[model samples]
Each structure stands twice: as C-alpha cells, then as structure tokens.
Target chain A: MPKETVSLRQAACTFVMFLFGSSVIMGVNSEAGQDSWISLLLAMLMALPIILIYARIMRLYPEMDLFEIVEKVIGKIGGKIVTILMIWYALHLCALVIRDFSEFIKVTVLTETPQLNIMLILILVVVYMSKSGIETMGKWSVIILPVITLVVIFTMILGLERIDPTNLLPIMGHSLGTIAGGAYKIFAFPFAETVVFLCLAGSLRKKDSPYKLFTVATLIATVIFLLVIMRNLLLLGPAVTNAKYYPSYTAVRIINVGDFLVRIEGSTALNFILAGVIKTTVCLVAASKGITRLFGLCNYKHIVFPLGLLAVALGTLLYENIKEAFDFLEIYQIYAIPFQIIIPVFIWILAEIKVRQDKAANGSHSPDSAQTDAAG
Target chain B: MNKKGKCFIIVLLMLFLLCGCQGYRGLDEMVIVTGIAIDKTPENDNYRLTFEIVDLTVPVKEMGLKGQVIESEGKTLFDAVRNAKKRITKKLYFGQAQIIIVSQEIARNEDVGIIIDWFLRDVECRETMCFIISQEETAREMFEIEALTHPLVSTEINNILELDQEVTSTTLCVELYKAFGGLHSEGEELALPVIHKAINNGKTVGETNGMAVFKDNKLVGFLPPNESKYYLFAIDEVKGGILTLSAFGEEHNISLEIFENKTGASFDYKDGKVKVTVKTDTTVYLGEVMRPYAPMDEKEINELEDIAKSELKKNISNSIKKVQSEFGADIYGFGNMIYKKDIKLWKQLAENWEEHFRTLEVEVESEIEIANTASLK
Candidate 1:
C-alpha cells in the first residue's frame, strides 16, 4: 500500500477540534471560578513549549511516528516498553472521551438509554472512520469544523442579551497558588493531551513546518476556551456556574429569545459529537499504529476494529456513575502528566543528543553530508 | 457493494437496535404538563401533587381549548409525579412546564430543595421552571382557575409575568436554577413570586399577590407588592414600573414611568465592621399627572426629584428592614456583593452573617432622572 497523507489544513483543523473535544462540555478549569480565564491564559503559555517540543520531535524524524522514532532513539527493548505504555495511554484516553460524551448524553438528552449503547454506537463510528486512515479523518474534520464553529458563534451571539459583565468582576478571586494549580489542570487535560498528535504528525503531507499547525491551532482553541468560560461565567454567574455540573449547558438553556429560540443547547450536543468523535478517532488511530508496529503487522487498519472494541469495553467498565467519571477528571490531570509531558520530553532530549552526535561524528556536516548521514 | 459495505450496514442496524428507540416519544403518546401545584395532604405527611396537562386532541381554530388537571399523592415529589402514570394513559412530560406552585403549608413545612430536586435532576425538566408559592387556601384550587386568555392557567400566568415586565412590576420571576443557586450559595437568600386566585367580576382569575422570602431552604416571610417592587429595585432588576409621588403640597400626583434602572453595591470596611452602600440610578419618563397640572419650574422639578429619591430610599430600606430584622434573611444578596468585591472581608464576616446583616448599616442612594412628560404635556 502507498503512504497516506493529510493536507496541512486538515491537520490544523483536526488539531483544533481535538482540543475542543471535552473542554466544550466540562468547561475549562472552572475550579478557578471567576478567575478561569486567567488560568486559561497561563495554561496556553505553559502548553506552548510542550507543543513546540512535539513539533520539533516530528521535524527531527520525518515520516516516522512516535513508535518508530522512539525505537530509533532508544534501543529496541526500551522502545518496546515505551511503545506499550503509549498504546495503553492511547486506548485509555480514547475510552475516557467516549465515557465523557456518553455520560453527558445520558444525563442531558437520553435519560433511559443504556450507557453501553451510547459507547457502542460512538465507537462504531470511530472504528469506521479510523479504518479509513488519517486522510479521511482529516478531511472529515475540515468539513465539520466550520459547522461546529458557526453553531458556537451563533449561540454566543444569541446569548449576548443575558450576559451580566459583573460576573467577571473581582478578577483574581483565588490565590495565585490556586490559580496556577488550575492552570496546570487545564494544561494537562486539553493542552498537553495533544501529545497524542506526535503519532499523527508523521502522517501529514511533507510540506511546510508542523509548527504552524500546532501554534495556530492552539491559539484558536485558546480563544474558544476563553469565550466558552467567560460566557458560562457571565451567563450563569459564579454561584450557579459552580453549582451545576455542566454550566455551559445550563447557560444556553436559559437563552429565551422571544420564546422562539429556546433549547438551543442542542447545539452544544452537536459540538460534543463532532469534537468527541474526532478526538476518539485520532486516539484509536494512534493506538492501532502502536499495536501494529509492536506486533510487526503489515497494516494498521487490521487492528483498528479490535482496539476500538477494547476502547468501548473499557469505557463501560471505566466508572460506576457520572460522579465517579468526574472524580476521574480531577485525578486525571496528575495521572496523565508522565505520559503527556515526561516521556515525550525525555525522548526529545535523547533525539537531540543523537542528532548532535551524528553531526559530530560526520566532522564536516552540511546539507550534502546530512543526506549521507540520513542514508547511513 | 463489497463485504465491507455489507458489514457496515449490519453494524448500523445493530446500533439502532441497541439504542432501543429510548427517546422516541410520539406526540399522541405523550402528555404535555404545563404547570404543577403541590400541597400537603390533610392527614398524612404525603404531598398532593396536581398536574395541568394540555389536551392535544383539540383543534387549532376552535376558540375553546381543553386541559385536564390530575392529582395524586405520594411520600416524595418524584413518587407523586410518577404515580400519575397509574391513572393517566400517556407519559407526563414536564419539558413544557413553566410554573411550579407550592402551597403555603408546603413552603413553610417542606424543604424546597428536596421538592425541586426531582425537577432539577429530570432530563425532561427545564431549568426555566418558575417557582411560585400559592396564596390560595388550597393550592389545587389555584390550578383549577380557568385562564381568562390562554387555554391553561400556567400559560396565562407565564403571560402575566411577561407583561408584568412593563408597568409597575410587582413580582420577580425566579427560575429553577437561580433558585437552586440561591439555595446552594453561602450567604445568599432566595425570594419567589406568590400567586393566588382572585375573583374579578364574579370570575376566578389568577394574579400575583406579592413575593415569598426564604431563609436557607424554608419559607420565612412574605412581602407585599410595594415592598417586592422595592426589593427588586434594591437588587437592580426593575425593568419598567410606575412610581407615584406627591407634589404641589400633596394636591397633585405625578407618576413616573421607569425605563432604565442600574444598581451598584460597594462595601465599606471600617474598624472590624462592614457597611454596604447601594446606589441606584433610575431613568423615568413622566406618565401621568392629576387635574390642575401645570408646567413646573426648575426648583419644583428638583423638589420632585428629591421626593422621588427619598421615596425610593425609604421603601427600599423598609423592605430590607423587614427581610433583615424580621426574617433575618439576606435576600438582597448584600453578602454576595461583599463576597464579590472583597473576599477577605467577606470571609471575616461569613460567620454569623445573618446577625451581622441585621445590624449592618446600609445606605440607599437613588438618582432619579425624569426624561420628559408624555403627549399630555
């Protein structure tokens, strides 16, 4: 089979949508209360260097996914251990997204529907999409991205009447330590979680630098996070915003424009569907890639179905109830730190050492000698 | 199609079968509950819940609309609501319910937090449901009153509240989540509109009596229309209302129509004590004048403004006093204001806030601007 590639535009769209995956529903760092936007600002700045590390790692090893790059940088035995961990993280992250979305639907729209059914249907779609490879997933994201954007923009515009700007006052309401802690949580879940993209960076068509995609996507997502957090805060006020589990849903539910446009909260449901599907699909694709490489399989598509089923099963067994799922979110920030940040940075350092050592060994490094070094 | 297409189609079919069409409710199979009224049972501790269900069988062109009121009793609110399924043929859907009326007994005896817990947790229930305390002797009797305009009592009450947004607004429409917010808030209190059946020209009609104040989760006191208006003013929520003032030595009455109202609160911390200053800016247009009305000079207009300002201050303070001294409930959200402005000061004052609030000094300032007199001028 020929190498499949996605356009840079599609990659950027997929990245932005993935950032919005669960942030749109759970809200961004609401623990900071009225100071959530401050936490978000700090989260974006903190996430920049890590996301840049991901791009740099990809640029260093073109056409090689994290699995391949790790094997080259680290020995085979060490790389296999890291590959297993990456695969497990990918599978676990995919199930968590599935559970997040299915729990939302269970509580909000479909009360009596079995949670397993929701997870199954979602995983089915994700399996089919992942099987189609990265190009199809990227193109699908590009197509649905605008629709989701318009839905969000229109909901924000319609909600303009109910926003009480006083809700945002008394900024920096929490202690600096608390606000920074909230920033760490935000950085881990949505921002640092982009480490899964390292497995995807190698799939983009060879062209411009991947930095443009990461930086531009992060900026767009940060703006969206700010808009959503501020809108929920202003519309619901701090008291209600903290009381309700899903503040954004409740805020949109209160939008009564001449009684005609009531219940526009279903737009939020649409947003969760688009982003959640894309996020889960990317995770599944990455996990399948790791599994295929681990087993020396010929094609990654063969494992997408089984791994997708495994994700659905894990989602059902993840938590007993919605409260437990939320408790997991509170702990997930710390739980994901090592996988999302520590391992990637470690590999990047090793790769950097290897690149410099190669240049040193060459002794007359230039563009021509670099080509020879690559062939060697 | 190839094997992959066939397998994809099979999986789609299985998916639909798995979902079981859970949310598919046909119009005919579902009953739309527009309003609910709850009252304490005469003998037991159970609650008698009445539901105002819309009858969809009626045609659109017919002037006469049909609705049914069903009553049931259970130990809990959810039990009572679900018990309706025994008598009714279709499922009772509350997504359209706009009003929830609780009897004075329930408001005083039952915990509203527990009563509304079911509504808040139900997926079909909306967060915009209005909480109303029935002033009628029997709450079910209030739901039985035929609406003069709309087909259902709830729709009529909803309309009345909407229209009340304009002239002399007496009651505040408190949504379910806002009520929940107040109930869950640290030092904030909750207030809901009171409704009752009134006999007008021998016809039973529903109207807003005043407002009910809640301390924590239980009903504590009631405020009349005048005081409720002032409470809304203090909270800076008055949209449009008429303010009547006396001028020309009480001989002539001038009514000002409120157009814009802004309320701001500032905290003054001095010597381990807190003082909340409430400043209100009101923009009004002259609406009515008694007989023997004449163009007034700048001095008289200033005098009228002063009278309006003093009147606003007195009524607002009186409302606060009644809620503070009598009920010891901080329904004006002064504590919330303090918390927003200065958290450290609020934390120091958080304990025994009710006592502090009762004795705390509150300065009410009103700036009234009269835009112009209407066409009568």
Candidate 2:
C-alpha cells in the first residue's frame, strides 16, 4: 500500500485539537485556584523542550515512523520490544480519552444512557475515521478546528458581561512551589502527551518542518487553553471554579443574554466530542501502525477494528465512577513520565549521536547531512 | 454491494434499532418541574418535597394556568423525589426548573448546602436556577398561593427577582453555583432572597419580602427590605435602586435613582482590634425632587450631593451594625476581602472572624455623584 501524507497546516490543526481533547474538559491546574492561568503559561514553557526533542527525533529519520525508527536505531529484538510498549501506550491513551468523554457525557447530559453505549458509538466513529487513514484525519481536523474555535470564541464573548474583573486579582496568590506543582500536573496530561504524534509525524508532507508544525500547534492550543481557564476563573470566581467538576461547562451555563440565550453550556459538549474524536482516531491509527510494523504486516487498516474494540473494553475497566476516573489523573501524570519524557529524550540523544557519526564517516560537514543520510 | 459496504449498512441499521434513543424521552412521557420546595415534615421527620410541575395543556394566554404540585415524603431528598413517581405517571424533569424554594424550617434546621447538593449533583438541573427561602411556615404554602401575574408562582417570583435588580436590591438573585460557592468558601456567607405570600391590593400574591442571611449553612438572621439595599450597595452589587435621602433640614424626601456603584473594602489590624473601612462610590439620577422642583444652582446641587452622601454613609453603617450586632454574622464578606488583599492576614483572622467582626470598628465613606437630573428639570 502507498504511504499517506498530509500538509503541515493540517498536521498543526489536528495537533491542537488533540491536545485540547481532554484538557479543556478536565480543566488545567485547578489547585492553583485564581492562579490557574499562570500555571498553564508555565506548563507551556515546560513542554517546549520535550516537544522539540520529539520533533528532532522525527527529523533524524525523515521517512521512518516511530516504530521503524526504533527498530533501526535499536537492534531488531530491542526495537520490537520498544514497538510493543509504544502500541500499549497508544492504546491506553486512546481508551483514557474515550473514558473521559463517556464519563463526562454520562454525568452531565446522558444520565440514563449507559456509559458502555456511549463508548461504543464513539469508538465506532473513531474506527471508521482511522480506517480512512491519516490524510483524511488531517483534512477532517482542518475543517473542524475553525468551527470549534469560532464556537468557543462566541461563548467567551457572550460570557463576558457576567465576568467580574476582581476575580482575577491577587495574581500570584500561590507560592512558587504550588504554581510549579500545578504546571507539572498540566504538563504531563496535555502537553507532554503530544509524544504520540511522533508516530504520525512521518506522514507529514516531505517539505514540511515537523518543528514548525509542532510549535505552531502547541502555541494555538496554549492560547485556547488560557482563554478557557480565564473564562472559568472570571465567570465562576475562584471559589466556584475550584469546586465544580467541569468549570467551563458550569461557567457557560450562567450566560444570560437577555435570558433568551441562556443554558448554552451544551456547546461545551460539542467541543468535547469533536476534539475527542480527532484525538482518539489519531491514537487508534498510530497504535494500528505500531502493531502492523511489529508483526511485519503489509497493511495497518486490517488491525484498526480489533484494536478499537480493545480500547472500548479498556475504557470500561479504567475506572468505576467519575471520582475514580479523576483520581487516576494524578497517577496518570506520574505514570506517563517514562513514555512522555524519558523514552523520547533517550531516543533523541541516540539519533543525534547516529547523525553525527554518519556525518563523520562520510567526511561531509554539510548542513544537509540528514537528507543525504535519509537518501542512503 | 461489497462485503464491507454490506456490513457497514447492517451495523448502522442495528445501531438505530438496537439503541432505541438512549437518553431521549417523549414529551408526553416526562413532566417538566418548574420549581421545587423542601420542608421537614412534622410527623415522620422526613422531608416533605413539593414539585411544581408545569401543566402543558393550559394555553399560554390563559389567566390561571394551574400547575400540578405533587407532594411526597421520604428519608432523603432523592428518595422523596423518586417517591413522587408513585403519584405522577411521568418522570419528573428538572431541566426547566427555575427556582428552588427552601422553607424557613429547612433554613433553620437543615444545612442549606446539603439541601442544594441534590440539585447540583443531578444531571438534569441547571446551575443557573435561582435559590430562594420562603418566609411562610412551609415552602409549599408559597407555591399554593396564586400568582398575580403568571400562572406558575415560581415564574412570577423569578421574573420579580430578575427585575428586583433595577427596582430594589431587597431580593438577591442567588444562582445555584453562587450559593454553593458561598457555602464552600471560608469566612464567606450566603445571602438569598426571601419569598413570601402577601396580601397585595386585596389579593394574595407572591412577594420577594427581604433577604435571608446564612453564616455557614444554616440561616443566621433576616435583613429587612429597607436594609437589604444598603447591603447590596456595600457589596457593589447595586445595579439600579432607589435611595430616599431625608437627612436634609425639615426632612426633604429626595429620591435618588442609583445608576452605578463601586465598593472598596480595606482592613486594618492593630493590637487585636480590627478596623474595616468600606468606601462606596454611588452615581445616581435625580429621580424625584418632592419639594416642587426648583431650578438647582451649583450650590444647591452640592448641598443635595452632601445630603445624599451622608444618607448613604448612614444607611451602610446601620446595615453593617445590624448584621454584626444582631446576628454576629459577617455577611459583608470583610474576611473574604481581607483574604483577597492579604492572604496571611486572612489566615490569622479566619479562625475567629465572627467574633472579630462583632467588635470590629466599621467606617463608611460614600461619594455620591448626581450624574443626571430628570427631564422635568
């Protein structure tokens, strides 16, 4: 089968939506209270180096995906072992996102509707999307990102009249340690979770710079993140924002524009579903590719359905209730450290060493050595 | 068709047929709950829950669109809510519920935070629903009284409280989330609107009588309608209201319409004495010059401003003193203001805030600006 490719713009759009999928609903650094936005800004800065490492790894082997690159850099046996771990991480992350969406729907809107049914329908859409391949996901992201952005912007404007500027006072109310802790919590879940995109980075069109795409996507996601946190803080006040489970939804519920446009918080559910579908679909596609490469399969499409079913089952087993689901988030930040930070940095260091050695062997000190190396 | 296409079509058909609209309910199958009232029953010590369900058959233009009020008693709120199913055929839907009326009994005995937890936890409940405390013996009595303007008593009360921001600051529009916030915050208090059945123009009607103040979870005291406006002004929540200034010589009742307000609170602690300064900036329009409108010169305008300013200061100080001395409750949120200004100071004061508030010296400063005089001038 021929390889699929997508434009850097589409990649950036998909990346932003992916980061926004769960973070927008879960809220960022709520422990910081009124200073949550400050923590978000710090988290973005903390995430930059990790994102750059992922981008550097992608540039080292232009055509090879994460699975192929792992196999090439490490030996065949070690590569297969690493490929299995990557597949498990992708599948686990996908299920967690699915669980977050399903649990949120169950708690907020669909009380009588069974969570399993919600997960099933969502996974069905994800399966169909992943089967269409990476290029279609890119195009889907570009089309949906603007509409989602417009809805969020419109909601924020409508909520402006209700916000109290004094709620944002006492800017650095929290100590530096508390703020840093809050940044670490947010960094692992949304920002560092961008490591999954390394598998799909190989699918970007040949001329696009992965660094530019990743940076642009992170910046867009960070701005949206700031707006969402600020809206919650201003409209709900610090006391209420920290109390509610979904502060954005609760804040938007109070938007009374002449009382006719009240109860528009349902738009929050729309934002969640759109971004969640993109994020889950990307995870499934990346996992399927890893599984296919591990087993020497010719095509990844055949594995998408089975892996998606596994994701549904895993989501159901992730937690018993919403409280437990949230309890898992703190543990998730710690658990994701190995996959998101440690492994990627290790791989980037190895790739840099390999690139320099190749340049040394060829006696070529040109800046275009990576391109020549890829051609070889 | 290809096998994949055929499978896709079959699965789609199965989804539509098998799922059967998971969370959807037909209009006839569900009854819309317009308002809810909770009171403790005398006999069983259980909760007496009254649901004001909207009767859809009545025309919108009808004079008395009598809604059905279902009553049930149970050990818990959800139990009582579910027990109502025995009386009504359809499930009670709360998405349209506009008001939650807590009786004086519940406000006195039960925690307001606990009473509102069921509403906040329910998926069908909107966070914007207004929370009110009924002045009558039982909240059900308030619902039983016929509404003067609207068919549903809750609707009439909701409209009146919404308009109360402009007419008077007597009734506070406390949303569900805001009430929860007040209950959850340390050293903060919840002030809710009080609804009562009153005789208005020879007919009984639902009236927003005054304000109910809660120190923690239980009702601490009541603020009369006259003083509630001052409380709102002290909090900078005076959207629009009328202030009758009579401090001038010979009791000249000049009605000033409040158009704008800005409140600033500061605290000073010296040797265990706390001094709280509340500064208020009020911009008003000359609504009425009862003494036969005279062409006001600059000197007269300044005199009017002075009278208005002193009156505002007096009203605010009286209200603060009433809440502090009578109730020993810091509903003015002086502690919360200190928390915002200086967290460390607040940390030390939060433990004995109520006691500290009682003896704390309060200073009121009002800057009144008559922004506009009526066209009659």
Candidate 3:
C-alpha cells in the first residue's frame, strides 16, 4: 500500500472545515443560550483528556496506523472485534454527517428536492472523495480551508453590526448544571470527530509527531466554534437566538450592508455543505481503510462505492425530520460517547499493555531470529 | 495504472454528464409575495386569501403606483393560495414576503394558530414580516389599496410599523417566527397589529390607525390609534410620535419625536403577591407650545415632562387592563420578561397567564427627556 503524507496545515484546515459542518452552532446555541460559546469552550476543555488518549495511542504506536496497531495489540479475534466496532462507528458517523448536510440542503437550497435526492448527491461527492484516497481528500482540506476561513471572517464581520454588547452580560447566566450538560453534546461533534484521524496519523509525514498536529486542529476548530456562537448571540440576543434554527445563518442574514448584500443568509449554509463534504471525505476514506485492513484487502478504493451507497441510505432514514434529528441528539448523545471516546481508548489501552508485556517477555524479540533462539 | 484511473475518471465523467443538463429556474419564476391577508369570504363560510405580490421586472411606476394582488377563494387559506395558481404564471414564493394580515372577522372566528403553523413550517415564507389584523375592511381591500408613495406598498406599511417604535411602546412588529415563540413559550399569548381603512372623500381607504387585540390567537377587539402609539412606546417600539396634552389656560401639543426608548418589565414574586414593573426610558424632542412657555421655561418643560410621564403611565395601565380583560392576551410579553428576569415566577404564572397578568399589579414608571425644542424656540 502507498503511504500518504498530509501536512500539518492540511490537518488544521480540515478540522476547521469539519467543525463548520457538524452543526456546531445548531448543537450548542439552540439549547445553551448566548453563553453557548462558553459551553463550547468548556466542552473542548472537557474533551481534552479524552483527546489525549488517542494522542497516547499515536505516541505508543508511532510507526503503525490505527488498523495496524489494532491488529498488533488485540491479537486476531479481539482486534477484529474492535476493528468492526470502529468501522461501524465511522459508518454511522458518516451517515449522521451526511444527514446533517442533506437536511440543510433540503431546507435551504432545494426544498422541493426530496430528502433522498439530496442524500444521493451528497453521497456521490463522499464516494468520489473516498475513492480518490487520503492524498486527494487532504487536497480538499487544503482547498476548503481558506474558503471556510473567509466565510467565518466575513460572517463574523457582517454580523458585528448587529452586536448588542448587552447580550454578553451577566456571564454564565445559564445554570452551572445546564452549561455542564450541554458541553458533552457539544463536545462529541467536532472534538470527538478527531478520533478518526488516528487512522491517518501514520500517513502524516513521518517523525513529525501528531501531538502538534492534533492540538493545532483542535485550536482551529475551537476558534471557529467560538466566533459562530458569539456572532449569533450578539446579533439575536439571548432568547431569540435559542428559538431560531440555523442561528448563525440568520445572524449572517441580519448582515444587511446597506440592504444590497442582504439575504446572503444561505452563505453559511453553503459553507457548511462544503465543509461537511470535506469532513465526510476524510471519514469515508478512514472508514474504507479500516474495512480494507480488517478484510485484508490489497486496495480500499473497491469498498468506497458500496459504502457510499450505504451512507446515503442511512442518512435518508436517520430521522423523520430536522427537528427530530436535533431532539435525538439531545438524548442519543449518551450513545455516541462509547464510539468516539471509549472504543479508541480501549484500543489504545490494549495496544500499550501488549507492547509493554511483549517487550518485557522478549527483551531482544525482533533482533533474536528463530535461528539465534534455537542456537542459544 | 493509467487505464484503471482513466476508467474511474471516465465513469465520473459519464455521471457528471448525466447531471449536467439540469438547470436552476430563477427565483423570479416564483411569485414574490410581499403581504398576505386572510379574510373570510363575504358569504362567511369560504376563505379569501389576498396576496400582495410584487413583480420586480414590472415597474410600479408604470402601474400608476398600485401593486398587484391575486385574490383566490376556497374552503381553506391553502386552497385559496393554490387556486391563485390558475391566474398567474409564476409560482407563489413567500420568501421575501414580510406581512401577514388577518382580517378581524376571520381572526376572531378561526384558529390563527393553525393557519400560521402552515406559514411557519413552509421553508420560503419570510419570518420577520409584520402580522396584522384587519380592523374593519377585508384584508383583500388593504392589499389592493395604493399607498401614498413607495413602489411596494407593503414595504411602506412595514416602515410605518418599524418607525412606530419611537412614538409607541407596542408596535406589534412581532413576526411569524416571534409569534411562534410566543405561542410555544410557557405563558405568553399572541398579539398582532390591527389595520383599518381611514376614508377621506368618497373612496375606500385601507391605511389607517388602529390595532386589533386578541386573546390567544382570536381577535377580541381593537385599540384606538393613540393607544397603539402609547403601547408601542410601552413595548419600546416608539420610534417617534406626537404627544398632545391640555391644561386650563393652555393647549400643549408636544411633538415627542423619540430617538431612543427602552421598555422592560420586572416581575418580583413574594409571599402571596406577584407584581410586574413596566419601566420606560424615552428621549424626546419637544415641539412648539401653543401658549408661550415663551422662552420655553424649565418649569413649563418640567410640567410637560410630568404630563408626558403620567399620560404614558396611564395609557400603559389602561392598555394592559383592556388587553387583560377584553382578550386576556399578554401581547406586551410580560411572560417573556418574567421568563428572562425570574424563571420561577414564569413557571407559577405560565398557566392562566392572562388571569395572572390581570391580577398581578402593574406599576409603570417612565423617564422622559425633552431632548430639543422645535427651532421656533
């Protein structure tokens, strides 16, 4: 298999773009108040230790990719079980992301276009991205990264005119418990999506270490998340911001530059679609690789098309409608923790334990060949 | 390697080709409705939906200043809208539409909640438009009447609603989206601006001063144009308006052009008692005094200030009581205020909001500044 190399800059850009797609504003703002930005900050901090588990796994298996480490650590039956769980998790996440993107498109761009049609169009892009491999998807991260930055900057700038500073007052107006609660749902999205990147950690230019790379990505996503929540809060104030759907988008719409640049509300929606596509591309590529490694396939591209179709079907049936989808997130988020954090940590633990035991039992295991062992 | 990649590329190319011929029809194809009026048919059983659709390409200047409205009658508002399809070639698009006016006759009779839910759910319907109740005339007539100026009459109507913020505290600038919030909210009743025709010569006029009051979503009665002004101010909608007062020897008509005004209510809950304080801060431009406060005496100005405060306070209390008793609707959003200020009070008063609001003592305090005297001073 050809090893791919993605730059640190590509990883940051892709993370920023992916956060834009994962309903960052929709997840935190609708329930959390104008202080949703605070929730996001807290959630990112909360998810840090969990993020470090993956970092530790990458540290332990510096030379091995996610699939390689799983096999080396869990030993066949256990490894395959973990690999299958991860594959299912990625597939489900890819489905959710696809659902969010298609639902957005259905509500914003193509109201008459059936949900299935939107999912189909989105799935086509995801499949093409997956088939093209990490090298090409990383190229997308590089391409979409700048566009996303411009969008965030422009939206924040335009949205500034409506900023009533009073909305920011009485900091931590949300009950401590409520704020604490929203943080986890908010954290699972952009923060947890970082877990999938472990599959491509080895593909990053060797010996550079993923520590700086993952940290940079998290920071970039955090900043965008912060700006979106702040802009929405300041524009609509506390209560109205919570009542609205796509608050960030409407906040942008409120950006009337002398009435000429009016109603570009859907621009954020466009940015989300573009960002979501890239994120799905990365995840799709990772999921395909996970499957290929588990099946011992020489190439992963063959799985991309079939999995892409499955993603479309899954998105189409994820929930009955947009409101229900977010409602499900409020409760069903409890179910996502194991996939995003637990499974990865489990792999990391088993990998580290086996590595330590193997090294202790056979101090010169690699250097001592069978001939040397028998001769001794 | 090249052959395999090329085959992949060729397949993608074929797919792109398959999707290439699809084209976007311009948003213009959909009728851009600016205002919608739901009125009961004269026969009273059917529905009359009047659409104030502005065709951008056709200049209003050419139409002698009147915008076009397509009227359709059916059993339901949706039916009326769909029936209009037969008359116009363009598809009806509600995205840019800003005003939804419900005729009082129908508003009093029908479930505005059900009618509004359709607009709320529709993707294209604009959320920030003014929601109104037709005072006396059919809303269809209001849609047909030409405004004094402005190509799009509804835009002018919306401007009036926006500008009313200075003179009045309660400009029911609440849109469909806000209306939905007020409905789903714990203890709030809905309110919509009331519109009526003020006739001059022998002609039918649709633009006039008056607002309909509703208990929940049903129209209960109408507020006089003056109360509408005070209510707008009470609700912080006062953009600017004139204040007229009379004394024994002097007639004081102060054109109080308000620049900035803030209306906020504080709900304080205690043992066996719940009270709401309605406070307003207004900056006003004083106008020409009929009897000479000659050099515009500070005493006279102070007197005028006191008068303005008392009048505003009286108006607010009266307005509150009328709404509470007549319609039992909390249009002023005391529920929302309490929800923000005291969530526990909101929970207690969430049910029977109107009754609780009526029973709850309302104390009104206002600070008015005579920012400037007309240049005549």
The lowest-lDDT stretch of 10 consecutive residues in candidate 3 chain A is A367-376
Q: What is the Cα-based lDDT of residue A216 in candidate 2? A: 88
Number of the candidate with higher DockQ, 1 or 2 = 2
> In candidate 3, residue A204 scores what lDDT?
72
Q: Write the per-residue lDDT of candidate 3 for residues A107-164, one digit (tens) a residue.
A: 6667666777777777887888777777777778888777877888897887676566
Every candidate's lDDT = 0.85, 0.86, 0.72
Model 1 over residues B113-176: C-alpha lDDT tens digits?
Answer: 9888888877788988888899877788887786898888888897787567566678888888
For lDDT, the strongest prediction is 2
**Per-residue CA lDDT of candidate 1, range A1-376, in tens?**
5677888889999999999997778748467788989999999999999999988788777667899989988989989999999999999999999999999999888887888878888998999899888999999999988888887778788889877786785678789998898898889879999999888767875455677889999998998888888878878777777766788888888888878999989888888898999999999999999998899998999989999999989999999998998778779988998899899999999988877676788777545336434533
Least lDDT summed over 10 consecutive residues: which range in candidate 2 chain A? A367-376
Which pairs, if any, clash in model 2?
A: none
Which digits, one per residue and each the tens of the lDDT, describe model 3 over residues B45-112?
A: 78888888876666657654446778888887777788999898877877778788777677778767
lDDT tens string, model 2, A157-225? 999988878687667888989888889888998999989998887798667778898898999999998
Worst 10 residues of 1 chain B by lDDT: B14-23
